[model samples]
Target chain A: MTDNATRDIEELIGMMARLPGLGPRSARRAVLHLIKKRALLMMPLAEAMQQVAATARECLACGNIGTSDICDICSSEKRATGEICVVEDVADLWAMERGASFRGRYHVLGGTLSALDAIGPEELRIPKLLDRVRAEGVTEVILALNATVDGQTTAHYIAEQLEGTGVSVTSLAQGVPIGGELDYLDDGTITAALKARKRF
Target chain B: MTDNATRDIEELIGMMARLPGLGPRSARRAVLHLIKKRALLMMPLAEAMQQVAATARECLACGNIGTSDICDICSSEKRATGEICVVEDVADLWAMERGASFRGRYHVLGGTLSALDAIGPEELRIPKLLDRVRAEGVTEVILALNATVDGQTTAHYIAEQLEGTGVSVTSLAQGVPIGGELDYLDDGTITAALKARKRF
Candidate 1:
């Protein structure tokens, strides 16, 4: 066949194959589904994607993603509980949000401190988080880091850094394992962690 | 906090909530995931989505999605094996391709002839398929439609229509159940169905 009309589909499948759980076969099926449901699903999805592409930006102050510099949690006066819940990434932050009880603001660390991967605190938003804690008068800094070795190490380091800052440093409870992440943990685990919080 | 950012995120959540199998909770998590993986996954996905959004079009011949009028299968002389395997949709055609056994051309019927849904043969690509069978000198017309009641009904109608065309009418076999879709069935089911070989 002349290779003209198939290019778009081929390209779509190529990119979709790169998704977390999708392979080339699944990608092809998904592409076909989107096209068939073009007017209802695909067209709206395309429009939403385009709008998000154009407008999406990371919250400059707290690392939360929004179309603004300061996210709602960071700016909301009601959210200031003198506590900042630190998380590894935005997904964790979203998970916490689903619990619907944590009225405190969030501090997205972006990632953990990993020497093996050569990732340092500087590479993450650690400095930014520290700055927020100090400027926002955060009294309690809750390290909701993953239970991984790197996560614990990062938590310890942060607690040490804020040793003399008059802030109560604490970490989530031990329900999450040595290598467990909040994303994988259910809502109950997260809630229990928040309730049975311990001093670092 | 200003309403713009909150509105934006709410809008995003609303859009994401509309996706198949994804609720408001999953949408929030997914959006957060996309943001965190912005560099590695989101940006490329966005770019690809943009390109696809601009270029995607339906194949005029077989109703398969493509950027051109006639699809790759219809335009290629190698695919015209004097046999046309008719499927309920492009997804079925794709499943057949994954098997890599069928070397003949395909005719995507778009959907089954659903009387309950008021879907007629005209709504599907039945007319186009008949035209292809005649114009391409097809000797064997394989009814690869799904094993649903409507699918069988459509297949019977097609077989009856081609009765005087001197073409041998056959089906994928009884391995496919009364309401089973070829897409959801495994490769083994497809292989068995193809192997059993029975006259329609």
Candidate 2:
């Protein structure tokens, strides 16, 4: 008789392979691992996954995921930094959090303005960002957009839109970073280079 | 007013840092990316995480994670190879699965027998494996233990226990792996060296 266990495991492997960075080989490995550590790692992981699924939702205002309409950051009274750091995606937001330095609220742009793809400001929540800036009396808007062509185009457009709003526009520093050597720095970097410029 | 957003983000960052292979720096970067892509990647990932946390459960028999008591693998009759490839943990089992050649049942030993650690046969699934062999009419037992000292000891002990049980035991073949060279072979490998190795 055909083995049902094999089919079932194969299905699980297929699902796991769909995850980012995991292929069929990795998925199979992961599944086997979970089975072996059922009591310690797998069981707990399953429980946690279930709990999160039941309670997680997107924050309506900022699009952050949490268990409520407003995530902890949005609901907290202390987070009103009077400035919003705007970015294109959640991955970028995660990167910023890794830095652990910023002290401001955020505005996730969802995606860049792509004319060819028909993605515009309306699709990217630009209107919502403008509303937050006006309502919150934000004095600065950090354009933490990617260094891609599309990202720059979107940034310049947003800057133009916010020009007369009395808010200062800024970005992450340019040039070789900490632990970066000057010889490795590219020609394009030298052009956008920020002088050892002063205080924010 | 104090910046509540920063504090909340920082707390989130702390939690993210505890994930496997991610440090504080990567966690910060991840958080920033999430903030930027809040509407797309971050929100969806959060939702998916929550859903999985709530629904994940371990298979009662095989320890595979699923929504029900018995994992799909254990319940499937097709996987009854009457051959259980024994492993030390789930991760190891997964690694074998990634190879995708074997099509037999599995028995996770959980851990190896260790005299120093006060671990005995009872601590592992040795008795359970014996019972399974009798119950399931298993013919071959593959000792897929690790190459570690404890792993070898456990394999030998299991072999002794199964003496006269009429089951053939086979260990994984060792040699220069696919695309591996004889010069890269370690001492153990050079010793286990077969006079006439089979060509795959």
Candidate 3:
């Protein structure tokens, strides 16, 4: 290969290494695999990425990512069930959708509140979430944030903000995960599960 | 997201999951990371992959993957040192290059001989390597094949084929690996290391 061509291969590997789960060694392996399956995978992946890049947009009403100004959940009449599930990111919203349990729409906060990072309600979609609750006549707002300190802090702040809005504020139940071993369960999770034990 | 948009995202994730080191979960994380940094990573990765897919080709003489008919090492004057390090694949050749100890060109076999799979000398770059040895006045044919059964079998076959070609054939020294503990060494490796013991 020429110098320029070699550089291009290296550049691709470098970009792949920047992904969340991949490192330099795996990046090289992946680049080789892509090169080996060029027509079948590499080209198609490139086209797909470009297609998404060109069309993907954040929803106007919620912070959900989609291909239109208003995301599918926000636009779908069936999803306006007077309840909204709040999440920290689009990945979390997708995870909830995958469960197929909740029929309500979602509000993506983009991130949690971080005092040291100088992130406040303004930095997140807190104001937009508040507006959506009132504008859409949402009867309940579910805080599905992570159990981390920052996540709980942000959830509490949102709940306090919605205290007078007539919408009931709820959060996901904390317990040992389904199929979890009691011996392996953490102290906090065991305590929570025990405190919230259900009656047969 | 709409069905079509959701399908696009899923399609991309599926393709990513097909890569060597990534699974469905890691692919989702990677895709999300790419989407989050669309301008910085996703678009650039797509463009780079497309560029490589369009340009990458197998070196006609050595079977190395590159952008031209002949790979960089095959075409470089400095690399034509009358010695060719034979590796099982381009990845192995790349590993050698990264080590930077070899000053000669390389011959990538593409794969090893496997009777169960019906692979033979013609299935690899054996013929091209033979022709190169004669044309390039190669003094040494270094077999850098893996220690696996198939790799060793292929190396022996190549060494036998070059018996009367006036070229010296050699294999890499087998010993305890760098930073490897003797206590953790496997039996075969330990035996090989002992058999090949040298003066300090």
Candidate 4:
């Protein structure tokens, strides 16, 4: 390859390697694939990326990323169930939407309260969430945070903040996951599953 | 997300899922990551893609993709080693370059002969390779195709075509790979390694 061309391609591979799941080797492979299938894959991907770059924005109300000011769930009258499912990030909200079970809207906190990272409740959407619960007449606030130390701490903080707001605060049940083998289950999960065991 | 906003995000995810290694779940994750790090990663990646999309082109002489008419290797005076490494595709050529051992230029065949796929010598760059061998005063042609059945067939065919051309045609040695365990090697590889054993 020419010097400039090699540099461009290498820059692309470098950027690709920085992505979440890709490494240098896989980025090289992906670049080769993109070059070969430029018309079919690369061009469209480039266009899609440009479109997304220009349009994608965080929903003002719930912090969900979309191409609009407010997310669909937040704007939809049908989703006004007076219950807000709070998540750490947009990925969790997307996972919940994929499940297609939750009829309520969501509140994306962006991240948990991490003392090491110096991230507090102000860094997240905690204050905004409180305001929404009070102004929207919310009845339930489901804390669907991960079981990590930071996640639990954030959940507890949120729960405390909503203590006398007339809204019931709850959390996702901790148990052995469905389809997970007992042998692979951690001791904490096994104990939680046993304690929360349901009658057949 | 409004209807249009949801469609736009979904379209981006759908396109991402069509990539070689990514699936729907990981594509969604990638999209979310991109949106979150829009200023840091997404915008730069999008710009890089656009630049590559606009400038990247196939080298006319050796069929290597670059930003110019002739690739650097093909045009470089130092690379006139009278040896041309032949590869099935541009990816293989790039892999060979990454090894940084060969001081010779390369010829990309675009693809190997596959009777099952109705591919023939004319479909590849076999004829162009023969012309280059005679015109460029080439002394050796290394057939670094894959170890698959079609790859071997294509190599044999090229060797026969260059039978009386005064140029030696060779292939990559098939044996136990570096750091590969003998127990993990297949029977065919073991036999080949034994047959081609060298004095250590």
Candidate 5:
């Protein structure tokens, strides 16, 4: 191909390679697929991405992504249950929303504290989370962070920070996952399940 | 989130899920990653897609995708070596390009002829291949299609059609792939490799 078209496509492939799951080879395959289905798939995908880029913004109150400043959950009157579910990132918040189990608002920390990466409470939205607990009269703070070591450490820090504020802190139950078999479960999960045993 | 922003983001995720090799779950992850790095990755990707969509087109002669009516390869004086490598898709053409082994241009058939899928010679760019072979003084037509049943069948059909064109018809050599172990290879591959053994 001419250098112009070739360079443009190569640049796109380079950018696509930066996505989480895609590597250089898969990115090339995807770009070719998109070019082949340009009318049906490529154009629509581009338009959708443009629309989202133009509209989507991070929520100022809880750090959840939304089109508006406060986010839907933060603004909804019914969601004001005096409870805030703290998560490491907006993906976790979306996952919780998909489950449709929790009715409370959320606090997205953006990332867990990582001393290796030089991240601290000031780097995350920890101060804003504390402000929400006091200003919004939050009675409960749910630690919905991941089970990683950094996640646990950040959760503990947040719980300790809210200790004197009178708001009760809790975490999602840890145990064998649903549909999990003991044979396939990891040792940590098995131990957690045994420790948290309950009656049927 | 409010339905407006939720719907917009959901729509983008849905469109992303349509891409090749990406399923619903990975699509969501990719979308969330894009949003998190909106300024750095997402907006640039959108712009790149737009630029490609505006310029990329199918080469009229060889069916190769390019930014112009005739691809750079077709227009290049150096690539007019009286040889054409035939492949089933643009992905295959790209794979060959990455290898940098072939000096001639290529003919992308788009897909193999499939009886079950009702794909015939007319469905692919077979007629275009014949036209190029005759008009461009092509001497050697190399079938570099996959070794699948459909691929071989289509290759045979193309060979039959070009029988009287005075053009030499050949196919890619089949042998033990590089780094492939005899213990791990299938019976058919072993048989093909054994039959096609060359001078040591």
Candidate 6:
């Protein structure tokens, strides 16, 4: 390749490398794969990206991303169960949807409170969530945040914010994960699981 | 977001998941990241992919991909060294270029011979490589093929074909990789490195 062509391809690879779960090496591999399957994969991917780029937007109600002002979960009448699942980001919300257990709605916080990063409740959708609780007559708020310290701190802050909102607040149980081996369980997880053991 | 909007986003995510090194989970995260940085990252990526899709083509001379009929490496005077590195795919050629060591041109074979898959010498650029060796006055043909069974078989076949062509055929050495820990070394790699031990 000439310098110009090589540079173009390299720039593409560099952008791809910035994506989550991909490194420079894997990005290069992906570019090659795209090139090899240009007709079948690359062209379609480019068109899809263009379409999404032109259409994708955040849900005004819940902060979930879609091709409209309101996300599917937020707009669906079937999900109007007066329950809101709070998550740190859209990825967590998508994970919850994949589980197919949550029949209500979701609120994507964008990120959690981080003292080092100077992030606060105001930086997230906390205020919007409170408004939704009152306006939508939400009866429950499920905190599905990660088990990290910052995640818990954000959950506690949100719970405190909703103290006088007349809504039930619950968090996911901390215990041995399904399919987890006892040998690989951490001390904290093992302790939590033991303490929360059921009558079974 | 209605069903139509959800379908659009889901379609994009499905296309992304088909790319190499990206699973359904990583694709979801990547889509979210792209949506988050739509103006800065996603739009440029979409444009770049579109440009590459429109203009990228294979070089008629050495089979390397470029925007022109002849690839940059093939047309460059500086890279006109008598050595011609042979690789099974464009990705290997790109990898060699990234190392910034090889100054010669390359011949991409597209793929190796796989009898089970019914692939033969005619399926690759073996004939064109021989023609280039004579036409371009190539002195050395470096076989940078993968170390798979099919790759080695293809290498040996190419070497045998070039026996009387006055071209030196060579393959990459098999041994321990740089920065690789001995504890993590596989048995085959350890044996090969021991057999090919050289003066330190």
Which numbered prediction scores highest in TM-score against the true structure?
Answer: 5
**Local accuracy of candidate 5 as per-residue lDDT tens digits, B14-128:** 8878777788888888998999888899999998998898889999988888888989888998999999999999889988988988999899999999999999999999999
Over the stretch B117-169, how does candidate 1's per-residue lDDT look in tens digits?
A: 99998998888888877887899999998877888899999999898989999
Worst ten in a row by lDDT for model 4 chain B: B1-10
* C-alpha RMSD of candidate 3: 2.3
Model 2 chain B: weakest 10-residue lDDT segment is: B45-54
Per-model interface RMSD values are: 3.4, 7.3, 1.5, 1.6, 1.3, 1.6
Candidate 3 per-residue C-alpha lDDT over A6-102 given as tens digits, one digit per residue, 9 for 90 to 100: 7899999999999888999999999988888999999999999998777776788887878878888988999889989999998899899889999
Give the runs in model 6 whose Cα sits over 4 Å from its true position.
Answer: A178-181, B173-200
Tens-digit lDDT track for model 6 on A79-175?
9999999999988987888898889999999899998999887999999999899899999999999999999999999999999888999999999
How many residue pairs collide in each prediction? 0, 55, 2, 2, 0, 2
Which of the numbered candidates is closest to the native, going by highest DockQ?
A: 5
Fnat for the candidates in order = 0.31, 0.05, 0.77, 0.60, 0.76, 0.70
Candidate 6 reaches a DockQ of 0.64
Ranking by lDDT: 5, 3, 6, 4, 1, 2
- The alpha-carbon RMSD values of the candidates against the true structure, listed in the order shown, are 6.7, 6.6, 2.3, 2.8, 1.9, 2.4
Docking level of model 4: medium
Clashes of 4: 2
Residue A39 lDDT (model 4) = 82
State residue B39's C-alpha deviation in candidate 2, in Å: 14
> Taking the tens digit of each residue's C-alpha lDDT, what string does model 3 give over B1-200?
55576788899999999998899999998988887788877888899989999998888888888778988888899988999999998889889988999999999998999999999999989998999999998999999999999999999999999999999999999989999999999999999999999898
Task: Give the better candidate number (5 or 6) by lDDT.
Answer: 5
Candidate 5 lDDT score relative to the true structure: 0.91
lDDT, each prediction: 0.77, 0.71, 0.91, 0.88, 0.91, 0.89
Pairs of residues clashing in candidate 4: A71-B1, A72-B1
Q: Candidate 2's interface RMSD, please?
A: 7.3
